[model samples]
Target chain A: MKEFETVTVFDLLIRYIKDGRIRLDRTRFEGLATYHDPCNYGRRAQKRFGHGFFEEPRWILDQCLENWVDLHPCRENQICCGGGGGALTSGYNEERIYYGRRKMEQIHASGARMMVVPCHSCHGQFNNIKAKYGLPDLSVKYLWELVADCLVWP
Target chain B: MTPENSLRISIENLERTRCAQWPHAQDNCLTCAMCSGACPVAGVDDFDPRKIVRLISMGMTDAAADSRWPWICTMCGKCEQICPMGIEIPDIIRRLRAMRARDKVPGILQDGLANALRTGNNLGLPKEDFVFILEDVAAEIAEEPGFEEFTVPIDKEGAALLTTIHNKLVNTHTDDLKHWWKIFHAAGEDWTVASDNWEGTSWGYFTGDDEAMRVMAGRIVENMRRLKIKTLLWPE
Candidate 1:
């Protein structure tokens, strides 16, 4: 803890791979994957801290998956998954799902089988959208889940 | 009295008292509707960010504040981010949320905030239950193929990482924590979670309570200080 600073799991994973702490078996994942830039870790943090973590998540995705794509209008301009701002827990399920239709459309347009989201709120929202839209082909997963799935043990 | 006439009376009252509170509420807004266009919840429950700004600018504060739309907004700051006028629309929405009486707040948000302030976590989870759940998950993981020695270290001082957890992960989806713990095990990273104030998401940020937010955040800081850990990997 002497020299370590607070960092996101994405940042830590990048460092771990670069510094040879861990090896990722990218060959394990062969599907087309798209990344969702979570508002808290991306745009809002950038606005507040003068730096947004746009690249760290993508870097994680690129390392773990052979085929990775971006959601249209991604990074700083990416749309909210509509479950943020406490809307998921706000007890407005109908309105929350209705609001997430735009995000659902984005996912549909991306044509990727897997959607990689870093935030729990986005995870919940996308899972609901997938259920509501009946898209069993599309799956929502956390960045850590992918990394753990692809870890190359010694 | 017709509906329009009654609305006029409320607008007059708003003009007399609340219009001056937000100095930039008027004149700065160009009524471009960019905020509305960019908002994810713009049309839900007839809530439009542009209309909220316009109504307030035109001394229709009561009409804007009285609606349930303000609570419906996720306050993602996308509208403010996209606003060419730099109107800070989300701030106005937050203020509107604060204006509502505590008991009048929608859903369980108010209760969550109260629980967070009282018990260090939004679900009011006791320290033992939180530890028990983590240990339970760890035991399950220990039986897995690769993780024969897995243990969720609580209060492990000087660990390289100290993490805060989302309440949903602990309360409902306890198995989700196994994903990160698996990663930690695979990477051989040093991380420990505090037995107290392990909540990561700030419900106070949602409920528009500054004091509640400070207390919730302060618990994390207090944990870090108590544990003497420097690096935090809070993902929420």
Candidate 2:
């Protein structure tokens, strides 16, 4: 609801941090992390609305994790996780996994143990990609999952 | 008439039919493979965005439309974004998808669209069932440490945030929502979920059915008006 001045969870969390309302425990997450930019929320929305949420997610990651790396060619240039445009439910399992090869390669190249994906589509896609590629070492976590895990209570 | 003459006649017919739909239809494309090169699904099922454009431009609309390539396209719009001629490849792909008969559409996508249109969610969830799931999830969350007072506000009029839920959260991955709920509780955000028409993702956008899309989107607007909520956090 940025158009109407409504804050996303990311924006609200940043506000909380700025206002000293919430402090995240950075040491809670020790594993290396990488972020995936969902196509709908990142590039397509950028082209349509003149603003993509490339930074907001990274900012959240920066606050919650001590060690994090960017997925290569990230933000607007990031490859699709191959589960968008209803492909998750479109009954094209093999093709969808095949399309995600580039993304899988990116994750493998990032060398991060965990992936931070904000979009539900991307979350599902990454989980399937991890399973399909047999990369049991890589795990996918939602942005909120990281934020909630790192939340420091007063 | 010879096969060559027949092909020319059909090409002319396709030109007359589809030219107005895309104003750039008449523009001469340089046959560059940029669009195909940028497309993620270009080589899948032997799908080539450049070839589709070429076929459509040459009045081979049937060849382009009949191929399974259009359905495989994710409609990412990267092809159009990278096109030198500014060709609307995704739009054209959407049109090809729309040309398929509703029943002939991919089963899951078609059923999801029909379910969203008929029951206000892709999973065909009833209002009571939705509320029950919300309350159930909320009660479970309440038992969590530091969230004993957590409750999912349903149909709370004038709430600052009216959020939509993806059907998968309610259907399969119910606990996935707890992450957001915990954050909302921690943030002290005033948000409510509508009991009816709470679906966020629009399968109409997926299927290219303009009417279904309009109805699905209109439900969100109608909910906002009815509840008098000014802000919406649609996370789909």
Candidate 3:
């Protein structure tokens, strides 16, 4: 940890997932959804802690619905939503969109109707991109919200 | 205090100074540099939090402030999740953003925040129209098969969960709120959507405006108090 002195991201996602308050459902809707493994989730939890850190929860999605969600540009190499780094606050309009455009293209290329974003900032940035870029049909959902929708186990 | 020990002491002090100063950190960053290491905007625009804190400790605000990393970082908070310290780096960056915002240094990206403040929602939709849009969408959801009883209530008081929606969800994706409302009805939860301070997602958080953020948060608290809600379920 570089800044604060507590609460690993690993612990948060794991505990949050296990909290039993979250649910997921495979049959709620039908469409090949893609997983936009957020930069935060891609780098923070997956690579920092080794594959073992992410195995369980990513597996949880598999358990809920196999092959329904796919990783676009894949994990460990996901695109930045371009809303971070105070960019949401930074005032870099064209560049911010330029960066977000890459991600928009990435998602568009994958053809996923919905994406599960774990981080709050990423969600904000990506949503901004979708609105301004006119890709309004794509839905970005919080990972916990999805988990809460389909909790079949304790 | 000896010369030999002085160097070590200074180094330790520097290390201590670099840790995030947020009182509410989740301890995800203490031993974890994962956020900085994994941050896409870090080296790309030289915005690494690890180095930022280190630089600050070294009296490097000039460099830190000049860094484009703040806008680059995305406030993902992924670093905290991986950090053993569990420090909420994203939160810290947000604070940094607010502080920088005070200086009037403009970036092209942050302009959307202004739109959010100007309009109740970022899409710049009028409030009256937004309300009408929400009702229309809720009615549509109700009309859908298996959603016959769904109602997207506005300003309805005394609901168990004080349901709030994002501004985007309200003005643009009214359907999403319908989904949440349907979910609430299905859960048998005593949730009612609040018309006043109904938006849970705060752009105030995005622009580094504590006063604005407080105002936004206070509105929700006030709404909850007035409505007598048991719990404030901020879906934001």
Compute DockQ for each candidate against the true complex: 0.68, 0.55, 0.19
Q: What lDDT is reached at residue B195 by model 3?
A: 59
**DockQ for the candidate 2 complex?**
0.55
State the lDDT of candidate 1 residue by residue for A31-135, as single tens digits: 778999988788888887888889888888878999888988898898888888888888888888888888888888878889988888889888877878757
lDDT of 2 by residue, A58-129 (tens): 888888999999988888887788888878877888888899888888888988889998788888888877
Better-scoring candidate (DockQ), 2 or 3: 2
Question: What does the lDDT read for residue B126 in candidate 2?
Answer: 87
Runs with alpha carbons beyond 4 Å of true place in candidate 2: A1-21, B1-6, B9-14
Please give the range of 10 consecutive residues that has the lowest summed lDDT in model 1 chain A.
Answer: A1-10
Runs in model 3 deviating more than 4 A are: A1-64, A68-81, A84-114, A118-154, B1-37, B46-51, B77-92, B101-127
Best by lDDT: 1
> After superposing the true interface residues, what Cα RMSD does each candidate give?
1.8, 2.2, 7.6
Candidate 1: residue A8 lDDT (0-100): 74
Per-residue lDDT of A1-154 in model 3, one digit per residue for the tens?
Answer: 2211223333433544456433456776466666666554565445445542335446655534544555565565565678754465565666677667767777777777777765556777777778666678777776555654554432
Pick by DockQ: 1 or 2, better one: 1
Better of 1 and 2 by TM-score: 2
